[model samples]
Target: MQVNSEWEVPKYELTEFKPKAHKYCVCIPVINEGEKIQKELKRLSHFASVIDILILDGGSMDGSLNHEFLFSKGVRAILIKKDIGKLSAQLRMGFAYALSEGYEGIITVDGNNKDSVESIPLFIEQLDKGMDFVQGSRYVPGGKEVNTPLIRKIAIKLIHAPYLSIIAGFKYTDTTNGFRAHSRKFLMDSRLKPFRNVFSTYELLAYISAKAPRLGYKVVEIPVAREYPKGKIPTKISPLRGNLLLIKILFGLLFGKYNPRSE
Candidate 1:
């Protein structure tokens, strides 16, 4: 359960914790989610079997982190002391904690309240069936997306997704979606080395999605609803900069610059 110091990026500590027992842990990466997180946690509370609800906070300054509801719901918060590529750094902390705790799998959903907490059972089912990486896709059959910005929607379907699909050698409907699950076996694989400092940003998810299939692990996409409440701007992405970083990460993986196999 010892974490290698070389892989550590920003130091973080978990607080306001209560332990429980279950097969899966839900990792919600957040930063100033505000009132939306309250609704998300309330919905997730109904999923009684999820042992841990780890809130990975990227230094929220809006007083959202101080909300009393989170502590009441038995949610453990890991506050990253520094901003080091917000989402990816938070995820690395969650993944490391989950591995150390010996959970069977970890499920990641956006903290902005866009993704459905109901689909969690579906993810756990796939993990039980031995699927290594389960990606949530709104573009898939039976999936739903509401109020998504036109440009972002188009970018996902036309450019981002298709590009990743091509590199993965498999058809993917939503490669950019952060709603996904990873079995412990997949996370602990030496070939995937997800804890490396190179994954301090958005590149880790993309790398794992493509690398899992390439490494001969079972990967599947499941339908999930992603609903953006009207007038709520997504905090995680900036159209121009996000797209540029994604393109750069894609090419990095393509050229084996970020590929674990090459390392």
Candidate 2:
């Protein structure tokens, strides 16, 4: 299976389920990504030989990713049908679920190919080096954002970056990027719970990163390669609405309104 410049997915030959071979488990939360789920799945499935892989779906309509398929193919899956909120809520749900199931660490990625799944190994390697949280940043060295529109890029630098830095009280080039790794101990640090942003996952990450230094967790970002599709995959959010929700999360953090559950 070779992927070309045109972004074609090669045929995947299924293999057996083997759980005793790996130490970590990865959790991906996706919603209504039928066309691209398999590609992410292929990236995950191939890597599952070295780690446990699980998919938490937010009630996808086409059902392209179901338990029967994942079970037969060795991937664990969980499907939910609560339209409570946005990306952050779904991820909170997924991470909490994966943690309950005894995963050592968690990696969150966009369902789209915007991030290359191959970076997982690098994330884990860094985790072993005494880092608690690892983030993927396009602005970092070796990290490149492909197919990013001019307007979005401008908005990120001009608006989101500054706003997030002040609100989260940390300086990060790409506060909105979803590709990240979190250790089990980091996840169990309940001081960062009670997330408010449901529209986008970045809000939750920013909240956590802001509180990480206080929690004594070492946070770091590494350069990662991103590939964007010619026609961007549809997000479950409109940019305006997503930004509005993000603002709410920002102010929530600013005014001392957020109170996470006790650890």
Query: Highest lDDT among the candidates is held by which one?
Result: 1
Query: After TM-score superposition, what is the CA distance of residue 254 in candidate 2 from its true location, in Å?
Result: 1.4
What is the TM-score of candidate 1?
0.93
Compared with the true structure, what per-residue lDDT tens digits does model 1 show for residues 1-263?
67656566467866745664777889998888888887888888788555578888888877766647777766755545464666777888888877777889999998888898899999999999999999999988989999987877888889888989888877888888999999999888888888766786788988988888888899999999999768856556678888888889999888887755557
- In model 1, pairs of residues that clash are none
Clashes counted in candidate 2 amount to 1
lDDT (C-alpha, whole model) for all candidates: 0.82, 0.66
- Model 2 per-residue lDDT at 259: 48
RMSD of each: 1.9, 9.1
TM per candidate comes to 0.93, 0.81
Residue by residue across 97-186, what tens digits does model 2's lDDT show? Answer: 556556777877877656878888888887788677888888888888888766567767887777766655556777778888888788
